[model samples]
Target chain A: MTDQPWIAVDAMGGDEGLEVMLAGVARARRRFEGLHFYLVGDEARIRAGLHSHPNLSANSEIVHAPEVVGSSEKPSQAIRRSKVTSMGIAIDLVKQGRAAAMVSSGNTGALMAMAKLSLRMLPGIDRPALAAPLPTLGDNDVVMLDLGANTEVDARNLVQFAVMGAAYARVILDLDRPRVALLNIGSEDQKGTDWIREAAAELRAATHLPLDFTGFVEGDKLARGHVDVIVCDGFAGNIALKTAEGTARFVGDLLKRAFTSSVRSKLGFLISRPATQLLRDHLDPNNHNGAVFLGLKGIVMKSHGGANELGVATAIANAAKMARADLTRRIAEDLGLEHVA
Target chain B: MTDQPWIAVDAMGGDEGLEVMLAGVARARRRFEGLHFYLVGDEARIRAGLHSHPNLSANSEIVHAPEVVGSSEKPSQAIRRSKVTSMGIAIDLVKQGRAAAMVSSGNTGALMAMAKLSLRMLPGIDRPALAAPLPTLGDNDVVMLDLGANTEVDARNLVQFAVMGAAYARVILDLDRPRVALLNIGSEDQKGTDWIREAAAELRAATHLPLDFTGFVEGDKLARGHVDVIVCDGFAGNIALKTAEGTARFVGDLLKRAFTSSVRSKLGFLISRPATQLLRDHLDPNNHNGAVFLGLKGIVMKSHGGANELGVATAIANAAKMARADLTRRIAEDLGLEHVA
Candidate 1:
């Protein structure tokens, strides 16, 4: 029985099963020495996979679960199987104080549903927002929130998201005051919906919060690195985030086509491989895999279903970092301050 | 006086004023022989600028305007000065049938306001949509619509956008039955708002339209080339378009930095300049510059304010193409068919 913080892992959640998940845990364990894992899944399969990762097996505890949540299963259906399913039990471990956080690569709708139902929201937060760090041209990656959590949000929901997002950014980016802005079509005061305008007015009035309200930012300026935290309703945020990803991949595909156009170009690509490799590393989705569900009572990190071992490990590391930083407590304190203000 | 189609040019609208706009028109005129221009701006400056382009000066006639709409001016304010301003007069030329189309690189809000006020919406259309062609991995560019034209739209508006967007795509992409889709957070039927779901239901029911409704698409797949037209509310469309542009530019910047990082990379860049130039041309916004205000009684094109000569010419060319294809009539006919269905 170690006193080290434990992160519950839904071992059977992702597209790749026990072997890849265990390998990812092993890799994460090497990077984070003080973290232990609650490997919740089929005990027999997990135990068999553990033979390959001796170091991880020594630090992990297996809990058997008979059912696995289907990737296409509805959240409502998945929630009914909370007691028997691996994903549900892993989340339960966090609720029971056996684990500090939970990470899953299962159906996003299911995870969000279960987490929201089981953990519930923080005192000031009406809803939990999905926050992720996107690569930017500045010194730090920008934190964006509500990436499909609440498709529709009012002014109050947006203000709470801002407080929660700013607190999360402060812990993750190590900044005292993160610059937050609403995502809109234009930067003008009269831009966007009444909800966005109202939220901006509230944020502007919140001078005592640990964030600098930078008014509004458009989608094209998202990766320009002008603002630290970009907030919007889930519909817009999800659209912007996914569009950026698609564009990045589109450019990469074009580069490949360009480099392979001729033999001379191929030679140039070879010579420029080191430099291009650096750019590739910067743009790789695996390097920035984890997306945290902010404003929840307990931490829940989502790993991309198609992510490889490195991506999964990155997600685990992110969960451990948030737990170590006491992000939930920090957010609660921020919300309290906001309430007082 | 000539029988050639005349495109009204807002000579004083863009950032560079007369020089860039005239140069762009001259370039476009060289490519399109059967085109004339109504150069609307300060008569003295346009005459002086056109002296350098003898060919354009021979084909174009100057329509003097006393005022230039300020880039930061509100739409309501700009709409009042429609009788005197360059952008307003250019739109007026279209409304009066003196010009086949109008091209401006001025304030987007001002242009949209003036065009809508002057030209009015086509029959069976409630609102005009801003449609633009985006580069894709496929042989043809994909058309996206309602890019900041209407911030909030109902199911009827979305369905209207789909019909108009498909008509525009058929003209622009030269396709028989352009595959159309509604942009949402997810492809699942139950994923988005009620409006989106209702719009999807309507589109799925309409089989008599010229477009092939392919169901829903996400932001990340906007440029994937599977669908010909993507329809969304102006807010989401604008965010997706701008984010795509920003990400492309971000990647380009990173590529530049990568190529200049090492001595070997610098040499490689010199050798691969041709290939990279090809990529640059493909990604350049100028190549895809023109955005048309669809469902309008007259053709109106909006150019990027900061676009160079090539960009403005592309906008002019796009306007000319739309005018020649009789895009407005096509959309009107599509809408009538939709109404009947």
Candidate 2:
């Protein structure tokens, strides 16, 4: 493994300001020995945050990007004109091999666009998909993909997604012959759209691939951890992902309100503190941290836009792990993209 | 209000057997005054269960249907051949005005197919849709439609769903101008498919409709109760509905595991039973018991195939409320379908 420890972070991204990003970087650096950071954003704002942490400031480098890509800006426009934006420069560092990988908590569309445009897709890859780790009942978490990358796709694209996702499962989660499935309306072969039916056939026919190609999986099977990699078009995937997140929040809030409703419940909650902590850790979005933009030639992880210090720190750690694992190279080799011109 | 209190129920439908159905019907009769039921199913099984429940036997009548439709059977095939199937006869009773409404806990596709073939769509209604009440954060619930009725729909069908959903919301939730929203990938007007875009434009231009047409609501807003009526194609809506249900179960199960991980935690959980019960009641799928097949000429409520006594009782109550409010007639009038012929 490479000894390089610095992570290029787009400090100007996310809904929060430089304070949270810088704090996250500081926290990560403090926790991990010899960890360094390249904070890409406005020099003035970053410096203001670093002033409180002398040790973090000593270990960190600030790269000034004159423009910041706003979350509301169109992705294509942001990619074209905002060359000096923090996110753009952060991806540039990764592309130029100055940084191992890049992490951004910005507009997901823009981040995906910039990362793809800057590093380019791996050989034989038609599109780059996003995969996030979802907590499951099983020993390991599940990997769900194409959360919001390509809205409309054909059978061939879905097959390719399965290939890439299988490679991801192997490299990221260390699963052998990862059980891969296509997200459909039902579990049967002929349940979904014609495209899905055709794709299911294609997935079944791929004998040479090193994947346990399971049959179709419905949305209900997602949290059940039946399949390792769940693939679908970005539209359905986005809905499922956001819905899960929202439901988790809703249920968590409901439990909190329930606990505080009465004195007896409050005492019970206090007694269950250890269990509650474990539960919170398991459901915490920060633990999942990063969603990798797969099929790209380089590593780029997108943190949730509303992520806090802990979330950002976890994202930085995720990017570092991907870099050490050389995830892109492994994906290329596994997908036979290495032979492609 | 019509004093005729009998509801024609399909006993041979659902995953559960005739005993469960009889139990549910018995519970419904005991809960509601002046309630009568026409249980249509296999003669022997229905009578066997009714024989045990003497009180239910007095108020209930069994319509002997020799054949039963399997949950996996094709809807068209089931409807074409099994004329005397429990579900078909239940719809027929409603068609002949023997019962105010029909309730089934069967294959949704079969129910919709039989209802469409027997009851026919209301005038000016292109297609019938399924509307299910989703519990929201607010005091009132949101009615989401096209749950799994029409797999493919045109812009006009969505417009019709909006009208029907708004009418149901008005009568059920008692909202004057029920806020209607087209479920889209994004809140923007041009975000989704061509059909959704066209539907949004038409809904925006509509002046005679009795609704506060919200432009769009994303999947996350469904739980937040941001809109009263959420409209979408059957495929996406089904995926969303199933996903929410699965996630709710996943979270609930996860909490249970967390609480039972240790003896101390179990004790804490025991003490907090009241709060847990409250949360469970709030998130119970049975609480929102029935999915109404809207835009049909008469009322039809589809209960969960796995629902127990409480769920069936709730479905009966929901059907009774719809019948008393004359929900189908109101929807027809609002859509100007009553005079279309």
Candidate 3:
């Protein structure tokens, strides 16, 4: 406990190879002083990349990993090669107590499969939910979970997700009682699948929990910033998340076209550069990078594969924060209290 | 067919009630020269409302229905009172062969329940799918289906939705062979639930069908203007749709704030008014209002409950277009072909 817990980095993962990952770790080093890392990847390449990133090199140790997990590899296939692969070794660092957390911008399914097999699920969690922060108009980002993790989840799974999500919000957003809502087609009690209604009933009765259950929320109200945690089955959650991302990008594209449509518009765009830049920063996926795989024993953060240095740093910071907050322990305690109630 | 079909309008439905509905019909009358309407609502209100719109009055007749379906009413409750409800009577006009199609902005659950019971499903269709046109970067809007009609659907239901959605797209988008894709979390074949994979396999094998069965599209690609028809189960479809709507509005809200943040931004906004207007029109829900209940015996269009006069008119125009194109017959024929294949 005296020694600082190391955070593992999959230096070989993502679309950009070892250089970007190492550089990202280097960037994160500037933000979080005293943060140490177990840089897991090809030793020679990582060493070579670290030449350009002296800051990361000082705070990190190279752990050689012979193989790399391909982005297109199936979870099963990736799991088979987890022992020697960078993603697998990084996860093993977390399991072996060498690292408190791991960060990877690798094959999502592969990373998830490896992390589950290595770290395993927390005590009370039947299935792990993939939770991520979505930028909202409110003071804090809303955490949405079970995003393509469990395609078909029962009421019990949904209820557990809500508990886990609330715990996560407490750690990440620093809220005492996060307002949680079940995602539905309509806000009415009778709306959505039977499982959803049952989950709603259970959540409504869960007065002993630290979280405040805010009832149902439709897809349209997600970014309105009213609720802190939104829970749903992976199928709907994934669709909603991707749809929101696509729509934001779609409108951004249209905005670009609109600004370039005429000479007068071009002048206006030039004059409004700062204002539009703020909007851009708000909408950028990179600014809101890092999707945490909750319900796991050890912290594992997944960065957007196409993300740049700042995004990777954000993911690392997020993972480090979760680790420091003892998110796993908090969730376990909440689940224990929930079970008692 | 030669006598010219009357499109039934639920004049007392929607948030705006008789005034907006009648005004929308009057506007549609201006666009579609010979379009007749069987306005179903309170007799006195219709007659009084028609006084302002001489265009609609000359082209249409009114049917009296004293009862109005409240937006909060359950579908079962509404169905029990369908005999006296304006929405129910309008649908009955279609079933009784007095009107070619019906348009309502009333309680969607009630409207769907009434329409399904009154019109019945087309042959080879098990459950009805709600299809709506969504704005895209393409020349024509993409038609997505099963938008909260059937919460759960099998592979067979999905296959049928694709066929119905394609048929709707052909009539609405006027494409010879619309590109159809199954909505999934990933573009990969094995990314989703068993039913989704099964549906994909079925759709891939359905080469004899009119639609070009593209493999799979993620929710983010929904507005990319690549596919003409995106098909999925009602739950995911509804979530994706509302998420898109919510994201668009979220961004629009942010844009407004950005423009008004400073005097410089305000000046820029004024100069770029025309360009922003184009974007606003492109993203407006009213420009894409009508949602068709596909696979039904009669065409029933559900407009957005909060839609304005222009939105109502757009829905009416969409319903009239589908009626003229014989959308129901086309879908039935396509289903017959699919069954044979």
On lDDT, the candidate that comes out on top is: 1
State the lDDT of candidate 1 residue by residue for A1-341, as single tens digits.
23368999999998977777888889999988888999999999999889898998678899899999999899999999989999999999989988999999888889989999999988978888999999999999999998988899999999999999999999999999999999999999999999999999999999999999999999999998899999999999999999999999999999999999999999999999999999999999989998999988999999988788888999999999999889999999999999998
The TM-score values for the models, in the order shown, are 0.99, 0.95, 0.98
TM-score of chain A of each: 0.98, 0.94, 0.98
The model with the greatest DockQ is 1
Question: Tens digits of per-residue lDDT for model 2 on B1-341?
Answer: 48546799998788777777778888877777677888898888887778767878778788888787788888888888557688888899899888889898988878888899889988888888999899878788989999878767889899999989999999999999898998877776547778889988888878568888889887777888778999998877887888888888888998898899999999999888899899999999888889999988899999999988778878988898888889988997888831332
What digit string (tens of lDDT, one per residue) describes model 3 on residues A175-261? 999999999999888888999999999999989999999999999999999999999998899899999999999999999999999
Every candidate's lDDT = 0.92, 0.85, 0.90
lDDT of 1 at B129: 90
The TM-score of candidate 1 is 0.99
- List, residue by residue over B1-341, the lDDT tens digit for candidate 3: 42356899999989987899988888888988979999999999889988999887678989999999999999899999999999999999999988999999999999998899989989889999999989898888899998989999999999999998898888878888899999998887788989989998998898999999998899889999999999999889899999999999999999999989999998999999899999999888998998989989999999999888899999999988888888888888888989888
Compute the DockQ of candidate 3: 0.86
Deviation from native of the Cα of residue A89 in model 1, angstroms: 0.4
lDDT of 1 at B246: 95
Off by over 4 Å in 1: A1-3, B1-3
Write one digit per residue (lDDT tens) for candidate 1, span B1-341. Answer: 23378999999997877899999999999999999999999999898988889998678999999999999999999999999999999999998999999999999999998999999989888888999999999988999999998999999999999999999988888999999999999988898999999999999999999989999999889888999999999999999999999999999999999999999999898888899999999999999998998988999999999989999999999999888888888888888999888
